[model samples]
Every structure is written in structure tokens, then in C-alpha cells.
Target: MTPSAPPPFSTLIRTASQQQHTEAESSTFMGDLLGGRLGVEAYARYTEQLWFVYRALEEGARALVDDPVAGPFIRPELMRTGALARDLAHLRGEGWRDTAVPLPATSAYADRVTQCARSWPAGYVAHHYTRYLGDLSGGQIIRDRAERTWGFTRRGDGVRFYVFEEIPNPAAFKRSYRELLDGVRVDEVERRRVVEECGRAFALNTAVFRELGEEFPLSA
Candidate 1:
């Protein structure tokens, strides 16, 4: 009667996270670009950006918290557990900048990913985004960074953005995804291109990290 959940998205996340290129470059990035060598300045800048990202997630969660469709998938109590929102408030009062010079590469990745969303069949796109954004991998990064490094939390609101309904398996979720994709009736070429473009979007993100090691990546 019901379809099964898909395999965990960890396959993709892990593959991306563990790139030797990304890792090696990140070491340089932290030192050269991020000021890992400089120590406090880089750390301060990193914290500033981290706060902005968490704040963005909080805003997104707040916007959809009461949505008829998205509400059930999200649990608000998690927000306070991480308390990112409260932390952001504290940081802002402390003079944090939401948009500092040389903005994060995530902005570029987000734009391209948005285009992929547009070209995708609405059903499949919904599945892709909801599942990708709502689960273990990306959320795990957010949680780890927030607690260990950022210190931008006083409650569970930040955590709310990371929580997902973890069933024993993901078959049910996959079924939902397949049904949505199947129903969308997208053209083969356009759908394929969208998938490819999504990969490009990911690469853009990778590039951003890679560029962090650059002495000066952008001219403007």
C-alpha cells in the first residue's frame, strides 16, 4: 500500500564532504584565505558568518513554522535546544554583521540550486529539496558547528531547523519522492539538465571552499 523510504542521503553528503581536494584546500583556506594562520581574525570572521547562516535558517523556519504543509515536518522545540536565534540576537547586539565583505560562497550555490529547482518537475524538486535540506547530513554539519564552534545558541530554535522524522527506514519517503516525480511529467532533457545543473551548483559550493585559500579570489 505504501512505498519505502529511500536510502539515506549520507551517500552523497559523505562523498562531497570527504574530498581530498576539498579537505586539503580547506586547510590552506583556513590558513591563507580564512586567516587560520592569523588566528583570531579568521576565527572572528568565521563566527560572524556562522551566525548569519544560522539566523537565515531560523528565519526560514519561522516563516514556515505555521505553514499547513511544512509545519508537520518541523519541530519547533528543537530551535531552543540550539538557541541559535537567541544567540544571533546576542551577537547582533554585540555588533555582528549579517552581510560582511566578500560574502560567503553559499550565496552563489544557493542561486544556482534555485535555478535547478525551477527547471525540475515541481514534485521531484519538492522531494529533492525537502529531503536534502531537512535531513541528517547538512543538518549534522549545522549542529556540529553550532555547538562546538559558533556558540550562537541559547535555546532549541536552531536545532529545530535540523530535526527530521527518522523512521527505521526511508522507503516511505522515497515513495513520496517517486510519486511526486512520476506525477510531474517533466521532459527527459530538461529534467536531466536540471539534475546536472544541481551538480554544478554543488561544485560552486566546493569552489567557494577551495577559494578560501586564495590570496584574493575575487577582484570585485
Candidate 2:
């Protein structure tokens, strides 16, 4: 009898995160936000929350840029903090930095990212993969909806975070990203830990969506 092959790390992370991923995508807030049922202010609030999370993620990326396991995936084209800053400024005006505030869930999420960046490179990769890959994928849908509903030009001032202007082909970029995930070298225990962190990342995202639902209330 042949032995079973070990699952790829990408598969492990995806499978473990499926439940939370489904819940986060299916959240009422997400539905309304993407469906164009929410106002521009709600989207701006979401953007504000992203700034906090990305600040932590990018800062962590700088710290782990030389780590063997994490360094390979740190592509400059994937960085969005500058784009996010531009979007926030366009949405909230020049005083955006002073006025922006992270949702409680966002603050917690940032804290976790900081902790992982400082102590565990593989752990940092989990959060990094969760946010950036998701941004390159489903995040585009949100960007389109925001532009259509709010009158922001495609890849223009307010939607710059999703633009990926530096990346000529998003599909190819994503394929390369998945390949990197598949190739990351880690032991079974560490791989499993990273998978769990991916699930936690999704849960953190869901909490933010739930809080948004409380504030926006799908009916409104």
C-alpha cells in the first residue's frame, strides 16, 4: 500500500480556514457593503479599519524581510499601506490621520500581527497571506462596488488600495503567491500552527464585519 502524501501548506491553511472564511463572507455587513446597500461613509469606515491592520502587517513585513520562510513572500508589489494612506486621505480629507480610529476588532487584530511579527515568522506569514491574498482576490469585488456605487473612478483616488497598479497581472501574481505558500518550508507542527492562525485571522475579520453590521444595520 502506498503512503498518503502530506497536504500542501496552502491546502492546509485553506481547508482550516474554510468555516471562518464562509462566515466572514456571508456576514450581513459584508453582504450589504458589497451589495451597495451601505453608504460611502460605511465603506470609508472600513477603509479606516484596514489602515490599522495594514500598518501592523507592513511593519511586521519589514522586520521579517530576511527570514527564510517569510522573506520569499514579501513582494513589494503586494504592499498596500501607501495606497491605503492615499485612499484614506481621499475619503476622509487631509486630516484623515487624526480622525481615523480603528474598530476594537481591528486593534486586536493589529496586536496579534505585531506579536507574530516579533516572535514567529511562520505565524506572521499566516496573517500576511490572509489579508493580502484576500485583498488581491475578493477585495477587487468590493473595490468595484465602491466605485460604481460611490462614484469613485476605477483605481482612482478613493479605491487606490485595490488598484495593484504596480502589478500588471493580478491573476498571475496570485498564482505566484499560491506557489510561494505551497513551497514555504516548515515542519508539521509549525504548519499546523500557521493554519490555526489563518483561521484566527478570518475570525478577527468576521468580528470587524459584525461590528460594522451593528453600526450600519443591514436594513439601513
Candidate 3:
């Protein structure tokens, strides 16, 4: 009998984390915010939280740019810090940074990304994959809703964080991204650790959403 082909690493990681991914997507805060039931203030607050998380993700990334596992995945075009800053400025004005604060969950989430990026590059890739890919995918839905619900211009400052100006074809970019994942240089044990980290990334995300939901409860 012929040996069966092993599953692609990208497929393995995604399939392993499907439940956590679903739970994060199904969070009540995301539901209301995406459903248009929540106000623009809620969206702005969410954006503020994102700024903190992305800053942590990107800031620590500079040190890892040379790592074989994490370097290939650190495409400049995928950086969200600048775009997130623009969105926050547009939403809350010039002094937005002064008042913006990460909830406990958001801080914890950013800390994890920092920890991974600093000590474990492969694990950093897991957080990187979880975030940027999700932004490229489900995050677009957010841009559309924000534009329609709050009148932000298409790809304008308010929703620019979701826009990948450098990546003209998101589908193609995603394919290449998955290819990189499939080719990542790691042993089976490390691969399983990366998959577990992906689940953890989504859980951290859900915690942020839970806090947001608490802060911005739906109107009766």
C-alpha cells in the first residue's frame, strides 16, 4: 500500500483551530457591530483597541525580520499600524492617542503577541497568520458595514485599516500566504505548537470582544 500524503500545514492549522475561530467570529460584540445594531462609537472604541494590539504585533516584529520562520511572513504591505493610526485619528481626532486605552483583555492580548514575537518566531507566525489573514478575510465585512452604516468613504481614513492598498489581489496574496505556511521549516512537534497558538490567538481576540460587548451593551 502507498503511504498517504500528509495534510498541508496550512490546512492542518486551520482545521485544528476551526472551533476557536468560529467562537471568535460568533462573539456577541462582533455580531452587533457587524449587524449594524451597534453605534459608530462602538466601532471607534473597537478601532482604538486594535491600535494597541497591532502596535504590539508590529513593534516587536522589527527584531524578528531576519528569522527564517517569521521573516518571510513579515511583508511590509501587510502592516496595519499606519492604517490603524489613520483610522483612529479620523474617528477620534488628533488627540485620539491621548485618550485611547486598551482594556485589560486587549493588553493581555498584545502582551501575548509581544511574547511570541520576542521568544518564539514560529509562534509569532501563528499570531501573524491569525490576525493578518483574518483582516484580509472577515475584516473586509467590517469595512463594508462601516462604510454603509456610518458613511465612511470607500477605502478612506475611517475604514482604511481593512484596506490592503499594496495587495491588489487579496485572493492571490492569501494563496501565497498559505503556501508559505505549508513550507514553514519546523518539525511535527513545533507544527502542533503553532496550531495550538492559533487557537490561543483567537481566544485572546474573543476576550477583547467580550470586554467590548460589556462596555457597549445593546440598547433595550
Candidate 4:
């Protein structure tokens, strides 16, 4: 069964907080390493140049800015994949790539997330990736979009963020999600906190998207 959606407010904060955490997760591993957000070599490319790969990654990261459904369920990688694909269609369609949005300097949180993902002891990276894949495989719209658009199939030249093998059907994977949540019993207060955080996550994303939309605009 799906984890009971926490209360409205707790979910809000959790979702919002989680969004930042997710972006930080990507940046921690992908950003500084790639040229995108002051990281290393990029995993993918954009604008037919290696430099554009950073932009493509950011474009991919920015997709979760306003997603409400992100926090309640525990698979962010999956969430990002779906959102990234649609944004690609939008960002690529018009000339939004050239738009200027301030890329904030790295923060403490981002730094930590990177450390966690990078120093992921043993199977952490693989575990994290599995969680993300679980979210994407659900017959949900986000996964569907990513499966079609967000290119993660190739290797070598880019597309390093995904784990293409070892996982089974998304539906089967997701069936266990509810059980995962059910095991983590929280009180009314903690539950409220989670819900609130989720909402915050959505609000933050909304603001981010609203601003970007204004600068970029979906279409005419």
C-alpha cells in the first residue's frame, strides 16, 4: 500500500526540503564534477558541446522546483527523471537555454549532500539509484515522460546518472513502497512535520518555476 500521505503541512515542508536535498544530491555528485554547478566533468551534454552538458544537467535538476508529489513517496531519482524529460521538451523547444537565472553559490547543505553521495560507503550509490528507479518505474506520468525523453541510455560521452540494469518492473518495485513507509512509524507531530516539509518543497519549486517560467515562458 502507498504510504499514507502525511498531513498537508508536514508533507509540504518535507517535500520542499526534500527538493533542495535532491538537487543537492545531484550537485554533490554531478555538479562540481561537471561544469554545470561548479562541479567536475559533466555526465551529459547540451547545445552540441561539452560545456552545454552542465546546462542540460541543471535543466534536468530544475524540473522538481514545483513538484508536490515528490516528498510523500521516497524515490527522488525517479521523480527527477520524469520531470527532467518534460522540461527538456520545454527548455529545448524554445531558446530557454540562453536565459540567465542566478546559480547560487554552493551552500553548506549542498556540500554535505555531495559528501554523502560521493563517500557512499558500499552500495549507497547503487541503493540511492535503486530508490530513484523505483519511483520512475511506477506507471506514473513522470516516469513515462522520462522513459521517453530524458536520455540516460548511453554511456562514455554522457548519461552516467542512471542504472539501466539489475532492476525489475517498476510496478513490482513500488508495491513495496507502502510497506517501507508503514515500517517507519511516526507520531502525529512528526507526521505533521513531514507533511509541512512536503508543502514547503512544492512552494519552493513553485517559486523557482514561476520565476523561470517568466524568464523562459513555456511557449507562445
- Listed per candidate, the RMSD to the true structure in angstroms reads 8.3, 1.2, 1.0, 13.1
**How well is each residue in 1-220 modelled by candidate 4, as lDDT tens digits?**
8998654432343344565455533433222223233211121222112122223323333443333332233343343343333344343444534552232221222232233334421112222222343234421332233334444333211232233333346556545554444433455565454445334333433343333334333231
Q: Report, for every candidate in turn, its global Cα lDDT versus the true structure.
A: 0.41, 0.90, 0.93, 0.34
Model 3: residue 63 alpha-carbon error in angstroms: 0.6
The number of clashing residue pairs in each candidate reads 21, 0, 0, 38
* Model 1 lDDT, full chain set: 0.41
Query: Which candidate has the top score in lDDT?
Result: 3
Candidate 4, overall lDDT?
0.34
Of the candidates shown, which would achieve the greatest TM-score relative to the real structure?
Answer: 3
The local lDDT score (0 to 100) that residue 119 gets in candidate 1 is 39
Q: Judge candidate 3 against the unseen true structure and give its global Cα lDDT, from 0 to 1.
A: 0.93
In model 1, the Cα lDDT at residue 145 comes to 51
Model 3: residues with Cα > 4 Å off, grouped in runs: none
| TM-score attained by model 4 | 0.37
TM-score of each: 0.45, 0.96, 0.98, 0.37
Residue-wise lDDT of candidate 3 within 18-61, one digit each (tens)? 88888988889988988899888999999999999999999978
Q: By summed lDDT, which 10 consecutive residues of candidate 2 come out lowest? A: 7-16
User: How many clashes show up in model 1?
Assistant: 21
